[model samples]
Target: MSIERIEKRQGATLVAPALLWTLVFFVLPFLAMALMSLSHLEGRSVVSGPDLRNYAKIFTEPSLLKGIAVSLEITALVTVISVALAWPLAWIIATRIPVRWRRLALLLAVLPFWTSYVVRSYSWALVLGEKGVVMNALVGLGMLSEPVQIMATRSATVIGFVHFFVMLLTLTIYSNLIQLSPNYARAAEDLGASRWQVIRLVILPLTLPGVVTGAFLTFVLCIGDYITPQILGGNNELTLPQLIMLQLGRRGDYPMASALSLVLMLIVTLAYLACARWLKMERV
Candidate 1:
């Protein structure tokens, strides 16, 4: 064989294992789920067919439709809040903090990630409870006549999501910020731009890639999350993941659960496409 042909063959050989693994783990399972989604439960046994009834029911059923809406709303809110809070904190760490303390700051920012996800969700549930520390402090200081309801509500879910995602977003935005040339900000200021103007016009534009990447990740994670909403929101409403669980566990309807999962996957795919388009535009 020719030398070039040998090199190509070696490259393919190196990638073969990963390709095989993906086929076995992801592709095969996804195909099975897709097939399941097209079948239906007859009493307790699943019957095989390319039925569209599950998809139709998802759209027509009020509770299922509401689950989709709730998932979208919560994901959007969490993404926005995480980006908003993380950006400034990232900027501070990358620009304001001294080099000596930067590592510690970053560590502290990601401290929550070390804890178990389920534990963190339950902790937040307690913290947002009526007699929790947050409410007790507010009531002690007379901020309210009594503790208000935050736990067992949508607000609690949003708070829990925001707390976790902010750490993730901070890491992305901080990496982006630290890579930027200090000269860019200096030049903008020398040209009579204020600090806010410099950040708005120069720094913000350059960091769009990291911000969007992080936001997209946050959207995917938050949308598919079951633990936080389940514990913190106290079953006040159902998100898509919760609905999928109900179908699988309570109803024993794997077909409906698979259909809902596919719908969630479709939404995440759409979001990825949107982010790709915006990033391409930004590059142009």
Candidate 2:
């Protein structure tokens, strides 16, 4: 009857659509998958289960456990490399580049984004192959005695992931860096801080939120990606996504795939929580 009650009702009405969408699309499917994960395959037939056998197998089986480790290693390596490369690039664009050309510089930096993801991955596959341009150049320049096995390895996967994620990290870091006033650096210099010290102590500390956000995104995407690792890293080492695909495509083991999917989601959730907490602590 009153204006306050009317406003509350209007707010609830506005929120309802989004809540419904999430429930229908995300929540319902997740619940179904969770239920399926509890069940498992019995020699090409699915057996209903409240059993933990699949998850137990995931932990106990060496190959399955190795997939988790491989995913973590590659994701971590890509995140670290991306952040390291992106920060300096974002800094140069935000600080050193003229205002008129900053947009153009950013445009050039993210040009790879215009290409399809599968195309980029495959393109890298060609570039990293033993007889690829890189190896040919290296050998021609006498840098290597022969072409090496970079194509079907973890290095290739990391290179692909870092190439993609560096652009994303640059954008996030640049947004943060541009918002920072020049006065912060000037103030530190006025206090007799060196350029390196100003950046390490002041600029880097302030950009923690953006760095963590970018790193978290990189971790989630890299760990879950199947294309690059399958094409570049090969079947020599299975990442979690590769393992999930194997379960689905080969074994038709829906339960095992569901369980692996849940595990991947859990890892992403944990990363989100850690980043969220770190950002909260930074604010405090």
Candidate 3:
């Protein structure tokens, strides 16, 4: 074979495994879930018959719709908070921090991801639990007469998500920020613009692609997250993922669970597309 043919063959060989893995793990399961969403639960078994009953039930059931709304609200709130918090931190780390410290900061940002998701979530439970560290500190400071109930509230869920995802957002946006030339801001400053004006006019606009990317990722992950909401948000908060888990596990309603999963997937896909379109426009 010619050199070009051999290179092409090698490239295809390398891609084949990933393609196969995606098909087997993601695509196949998604297709199955789509089929299952159109099915009906007949006792313990999921009856494989084409039906819109599951979709209809999802809309008709107020609780399910409420769960979806809650999920979206939480996703939006967490995305906003995570991105807002991440931007300044990422900017500082990327532009202001010393070269030697940058690596350490990046490592610290990603270190939390090395721990188990459940363990990290339960750590939040400890920090925010009644008689937990935060509560004890607040009580000591006379912020409250009793330990605040942060463990099982919507606020707790949002906080936990922020804690869990802020690192990811920081790293993503920081990577983008690091690539940006400081000259843009410097030039803006040389033109008699103040620091705030430079950032508002130049830096923020340039970093928007990163901001959008981080927000989109954080939103998707937070929306799909079951553990954080389940652990941190007891009976008070019911996200769509938690509801789907309940249907699948507690209620043994596979069809309903599948339907809910499909709905969540659609919402996530739409959000991703919208983010992609926005990014494209920003790039243009």
Residue-wise lDDT of candidate 2 within 76-156, one digit each (tens)?
Answer: 999999999999999999999999999999999999999999999999998988888999999999999999899888999
Residue 115 CA displacement from its true place in model 2, Å: 0.4
Cα deviation of 239, candidate 2, in Å: 0.5
- Estimate the lDDT of model 2: 0.95
lDDT of 3 by residue, 1-58 (tens): 9999999999999999999999999999988888888999877887888999999988
- Kindly provide the TM-score of model 2 when superposed on the true structure, using C-alpha atoms: 0.95
TM-score against truth, every candidate: 0.96, 0.95, 0.91
Worst 10 residues of 3 by lDDT: 40-49
Poorly placed runs, candidate 1 (over 4 Å):
1-13
- Screening candidate 2 with a backbone cut-off below 3 angstroms (N, C-alpha, C), the clashing residue pairs are none
Better candidate by lDDT, 2 or 3: 2
For model 2, the superposed segments whose C-alpha errors exceed 4 Å read 1-18
Candidates 2 and 3, the one with greater TM-score: 2
* Cα RMSDs, all models: 1.4, 1.6, 2.4
Q: Tens digit of lDDT per residue, candidate 1, span 1-284?
A: 99999999999999999999999999999999999999998899999989898999999999999999999999999999999999999999999999999999999999989999999998998788989999999999998998899999999999999999999999999999999999999999999999999999999988999899999999999999999999998777999999999998886999999999999999999999999999999888
